[model samples]
Target: MTRSINEVRVVGLGKVGELVALLLSDSGFTVTAYDARTRSDLPFACKELDVRDGAALRSALTGADAVVSCLPYHLNLGVAEAAHDLGVHYFDLTEDVPTTNRVLELAGSGEARNVYAPQCGLAPGLIGIVGSWLAKQFDEIRSIELKVGALPRHPAGLLGYAFNWSAEGVVNEYLNDCEVLRSGRRQMVPAMTEQERVVIGGIELEASLTSGGLGTMCETYEGRVQRLDYKTMRYPGHFELMRFFFDELGLRDRRELAGEILVQAKPPVDDDVVYLHAAVEGHADATGERAYRKQYVRAYQPLTINGRHWRAISWTTAASAAAVVELVADGRLPQTGFIKQEDISFVDLLSTKNGALFGDLGKV
Candidate 1:
């Protein structure tokens, strides 16, 4: 006899949350969506919930097997803590280091009965998985470089940038200190530093230091690789304009203003591009000869899914978080405890129903 499947609660009513809800609901799991707004339209008993209210959140999680939080990074810790208390597996798309660290602490405690997985988005999510897979291919990894970006498919502005993702998160990355492993030593670098122009498949993009993009990689590969880092990609000339604003104008300290200005000036668009680039250099165990090379290119492809013609950015950003939920629900991943984005194998991720977003990554 088939066992009765438990319901999965998806918090946050944003685009990503909606996609995650749809994917999980289609996968045979009953999904209950909750938002901070007045909870209604309980298509499956969806409720408007104040996720911060511990008592209410725990009550909402009754009988729920899992909870996937699509809330912004700032509200992630509260949700994870509640999930831990309620014995429901938890997952989120947080890219912030401090928030992730708190989640790790909560998960590390033996009291946490269920999984607490964070950093399930694009850069910190799939990028880490793919990077780890690349590292395993070499005998001894010397350097690993990762670059990712979400941009407008067609630019209509001078900056050529669009707010396809969270504007606050983007500003945070620009203002925070970046963690990078240089010459085999981990160090914190200033954001927007070491700018470079790179061309991928005839498409030129800019890359530079950005905070929190290298989630768990530095700690995972510490003292092992000669160099390791993650960078954010953007269109050419974007860096110059940002440097002028954040540096010369001293807007780095003014996060709210930066976020407001960005959102006000650059509206989000459906037509956008998601770029991923990774490279690793190491020697084959048998061959002691010098082996030094890198893989560098940009991926720009329009994609459509779930009756929506979402560009690469929307599909990827949404798909990464969605796939993790599917994996957990299917028991392909751990149901509880602290889980890293790299914890899930690439092959396993590609095999999921929503995994088509990755397509054939080719041989990197």
Candidate 2:
């Protein structure tokens, strides 16, 4: 049985971790904020510890009931391993499929005392839950499309893009092979292919196949849907710029260097928008004449947390991660196993303190 109030420790004090700690604290959990960097504004017990240091990580999680990771994808495995050994629940915001698979393997060790959940952020996180919610409404689901983006409200650069989140995660997705299910068959699609333009809120935006956005949806919907795909939304010219860099310039082979270049050139922005779009199409009636469609559109602006206002991208990502941890602490989730963001029920998610962030965003 899950306890009433969990003592939560957050690793990473970046944009995502800051909001995660804030939201968890606000939700009545005993929150502790841990980071190598110093942030005077954050609430709860604040400590300086590097999660990459396995010894330090275990020490930091000593008495904590749960650990929520807001670090980049590369740093997740160590923390997950430590969580598994320490018998504490683990959660993270990662879109890396391989990293997620590793976490799942670790979670399945059967010796863990608590749950291990990854991909608890925007696309893989919220989109998975939204897709699962729609799947339940249809009997013969045929197709599912998910489009999500963290974009700048105001344009400044040639790409019209902003670095509101992790540069490493973004670069990895751009370079890696994307997974998609076509006609009930799983295959690899080159990243940055299948470019298209979409208008959201009367604003014209571009979208295309990006790696890792689908999370475990491809496997979850493999046999159920004839077609399943996921894409990342960006400004009109972003895809063109990326194609030139990854394909023409051959930066795909040098992802680290490419990420360094982008970070040095294009930094994060404060005024940004987080947009999530999901649609599931299938038959509703037994006659096979009725078509059913369910869509979820959630948008978030810059918000304040722990008395520190952060970008919308940070808040959304961090808040989403925090919500997963809150659920596990409340015993709403599995205690010892691999947990996907889709495993979360939409109804249960939106009702929580941090989950309420999606309440104001109307249904699409």
Candidate 3:
């Protein structure tokens, strides 16, 4: 018999981590929060323990059914290693491709007794699920294009954006190579190179290549789809400005300094919006000879949860990880091994309490 997950340990107390802990607790899970610094203001049980300390991390993860790492992308491997040693399931919101590969290697080594799920965030997480759902609707897939962005509701400054999430993450995405499937072949493209314009909800924005947003969808649909790609959406003129910093100023080589500049110059905004669009074009199953295109567009804003306001990025990213964790706990997902975002159905994700924020599943 497969045991159900009841006790969860969430590592990190940042914006998204705090919400993950609260949401899991509200969903009837025993939640233990851990971080490097003391956080007495959190409403749940939290401990001050550095994840770098293997003994401390192992101790904190004691008896945990699952451990969710909300730490930065680079810091997730340690927690994942500890979780594997403790025979506990592990999940993280990392967008780093190399880090995900390392996690996959760990999951495939036969040493892990539980599942290892990585890149379980907004773009790579929910976006991949939505894209896979759309692709399945067709008899033969021809093209799949995914676009997602988190932008300030009220734009300011020359960049026309603000930091709604991690500055380092944003910079990293802009600097890394993006994977896409073209003509049924996997290809790697330079980030921020393919700039296109799109309009959603009457608002104009630009979409460009971004890294780690596609998750494992490229490999999943490599031979099945003729054209498949994922891009990040931003306000008009944003991509050009980023190109200046990354190319003209040569900030791509100095990513740390670039991150610092972005963090210092771009103030974090509470009022923000998350935009998601997944367009699939192919022959419908009902009419295999006819060509059809299906597109899903959604815009999410900040909401108050449990009497406290949270940013759109915070809740979206946190909700994605939380929903997946819940699904694993309920036996809706595989009990062991590495899991891909496409492995879970969009319907199952929408059925969760946290995933309901994506809106009604009937429309899909």
Candidate 4:
């Protein structure tokens, strides 16, 4: 019988990655954290390992049961390939579609040696699970809409934003084409379009179509759901300014330089809010309530962990990733083969040690 995951190697020690390591350690997993820069004072074992070096990366994963790639999306493919070659369970928080495709190719079909689960963070991670769980509550589902945003609570200038996360990731999402299920068919739509007003908790904000937030949901619910889309909510007028900056100024091609400038201007903030809003429209049952909608919406605020305060985005994303790993380690999830976010049980996800940070799954 395959042994449950107990030893984990976490690559990259950024804000979110560091938190993932902390959570896993607190949950009783022997964690080894790695990063390019040497750091000290962390509770768990921390090392400076160059993930770009394939030989060193594999050597580092020598005895680990699982590896979580906290590296950027561009670097995740190589890490995943190394994990597959070593038969170590692989997990990542990548939203890049092409990267995910390559990872899927690495892990074949059912009955694999180890697990390969990616896109296990905030929007594509938690949101996907929530949407799927809500869909299960209905007999026939028509639509599944997911929207999320991480922004500064206070409004500022025209952009009204802060670089709470990766600027490169943000730029990619803004420029890349999004996959959505429209009219019961998978369709590719341009990002930053489909602007609409969204009111959550009576705070009027705007939502625009964003890429990668939907993950593989478009393919999973292609023919079954009439409409399936994911959007990023922001303060009203934020999308318009972004369009002018990226399109009107022709900074789309210069993504790296654009990200640098944006981060310089709107650095990161301590007080940030993560908003998650998911709704499923369908029939409650065959005979009762032919048409109905169920929604899960909440505004996540900063939380204190281990006597230290963590930003909302950091804790939410980190907790989601750690929870997924916890489930896999606890044998609550599939022990092998690829796992889809939508296939993960939302109730179980919330019940996990780290996932408890997401709060209760609530009534469907």
Candidate 5:
């Protein structure tokens, strides 16, 4: 049985965590937030603990019905293991493949007491759901192209971007090989290759393969679609400058230093936009009589939540993770098992308590 979720815990109170706790609390869940350093500014119960210490993590999770990890990708695995051991439902915004795979393994271990729903934020979260929603409308699907970008609404500089998110996650996305379905087969493609021009809201931006945005869709739609891929959109010259910074400058080998230097150069911005585009081309009928193409394209800007304006990246990400937790809490999802974003109904997602905050999320 899916245990009733009441007392909830949120760890790593960073850019996205604070709002997550607020949203969940506003939706009526008793929220308690945690961090390595203490936090008192939030409107919820707060605690300080090192998640790496097993005793500390277990103690913190013992009384919670659920735990959401907003930590960096590297820290998610240990937190997930702790949650499973404590029989608490787990959710996260991790875009790292290995971390997700490990979570899946834990969920499938046959002793899991609750659901494990990772990849609960944007890109892999909402974008993947939008793609699956579109694909289901067609009798036969040919191609599904997914793209997302988070950038400053007003840009200045060669890179035309800001570090309003985790630099380590962005760096990892840029460096890792992306998975794609090419000609009805799954394959690994080098990231940053296959550059293409994408125009949304009358603004032209360049897009190229970035890792982890597709989540497990490559595995989900392997033989169903002729071609499936995901890319990250950015200002036209952004890719060139990044290549020059990472490859030409030989910073690829030093990912941590590269993230540090990049953050030092372009700090987080309050005025940012989150771009989403999902196009699905398929047959219009059961007999494959007609061809059809559709897309869910929008540019999300910051919006006010509880009288405070949030950055597009922060609120969109925060609401998505929290909304998924809401769904599980209400039993819209399985009580105990691994859940995929594609399995989520898009309409239900937009109708959740936190989903309203997320959909009120576009147009720069």
Candidate 6:
């Protein structure tokens, strides 16, 4: 039987981390927030501790039922290891493929006593869940496309974009190779290529190849689908500006410098919108002769929760992870194992209080 989770330690108190800690606390879980550089303005209990310090992390997680790592993608493996050692459930919002592989390795080991769930964020997390649910609706899946973007509600500047989430994460996805299934075979494709124009919510946008957004869908639908890919949506001209920097300026080779430059140039905006779009096409039923298409599209904005305003990205990312954690606590998910975002049922996820914030039930 799954044990009740009453306490949780949240690592990294950044924009998304702060919201995660606050939302978990609001949901009746005792939250202890930690960060390398602690903030005094956070709403819940917080402490100063570097997650790299294994001893300190274990200590912080001592009596907690779970530890949620909202740290940068590169800094999550150490926390996952610490969680394994302490026998506490491990969760993270990392989109880094290598880091997730390491977490998978840790969870697969016989010594692990708790669950390990990575990529529990916006794109790789909720997007994957919705994609998997749509795929299951078809009898012979032909193709699946997933696209998501956290864009400023009122875009400004030359790029027509603002840093809604992690600047480093944005750069990483642009530079890394994206995995996709083409013609019923899995393959790796260069990022920022295959640009296409799309329209969502009466707004025209552009999308292109990006890494880590597919999560495990490519593997899950490997031989089942003829085509499967995930892309990042952006306003028109955004892709050209990024290409000028990554290709023309040769900043792709210097990723850290690129990230620094981008962060320094673009200011983070609180008034942002999280846009999600997914479509699946295949045979509708056993007839295997009819083709049908199903799609999901929604735009989420900032919300007032408990007298405090939270950005769309902040709440969407944090709520995705928190909802999964709640599912585990309620014994709806496996108590001790490696959990994938695609393993979650869409109805179950949307039923959670935090997940319901997306609004419009049965619309998608």
Against the true structure, what is each candidate's TM-score? 0.92, 0.94, 0.97, 0.97, 0.97, 0.96
Best by lDDT: 5
Model 2 quality (TM-score): 0.94
Prediction 1 TM-score vs. true: 0.92
Q: What lDDT score belongs to each candidate, Candidate 1 first?
A: 0.79, 0.81, 0.89, 0.90, 0.91, 0.87
Model 4 C-alpha lDDT per residue in residues 8-89, reported as the tens digit of each score: 9999989799999999999899999999987798999999998889999999998999999988999998899899888999
Worst 10 residues of 3 by lDDT: 355-364
Q: Once superposed on the true structure, which residue ranges of model 6 sit more than 4 Å away at CA?
A: 1-3, 39-43, 286-289, 361-364
> What lDDT is obtained when candidate 4 is compared to the true structure?
0.90
Error of 4 at 184 (Å): 0.9
Per-residue lDDT tens digits for candidate 6, residues 1-364, read 4347889999988888888888888877889999888778867888999777788878898999999999999899889988888899999998899998898899888956898999999889999999989988888889999999889989888787888778889998998999999999999999989999988878888999999998777888889999999999999999989999998998989988998888888888878888899999999865455888899888888877778898888888999998888888888888888998999988898887777765552132
Q: Taking the tens digit of each residue's C-alpha lDDT, what string does model 3 give over 184-249?
A: 999998999778999988889999989999888898898999998989999999988989988999
Q: How far does residue 134 in candidate 5 sit from its true spot (Å)?
A: 0.7
Query: What digit string (tens of lDDT, one per residue) describes model 5 on residues 96-209?
Result: 999999999999997779989999999789899889999999988999999999999899888999999999999999999999999999999988989999999888899999
Whole-model alpha-carbon lDDT for candidate 1? 0.79
lDDT by residue for model 2 (220-273), tens: 777778888888998888988988987799877887888888877878878888
- Which residue runs does candidate 5 get wrong by more than 4 Å? 1-3, 286-289
Which window of 10 residues has the lowest lDDT sum in candidate 2?
A: 355-364
Task: Give the poorly placed runs of model 4, Cα more than 4 Å off.
Answer: 1-3, 109-111, 360-364
**Candidate that beats the other on TM-score, 5 or 6, i.e. the better one:** 5
Better candidate number, 1 or 6, judged by TM-score: 6
Clashes of each: 8, 2, 0, 0, 1, 0
Q: Report the C-alpha lDDT of model 1 over 4-40, residue by residue, as the tens digit.
A: 2357888887867777777777667788888878545
lDDT of 2 at 256: 83
- Displacement of the residue 255 alpha carbon in candidate 6, Å: 1.0
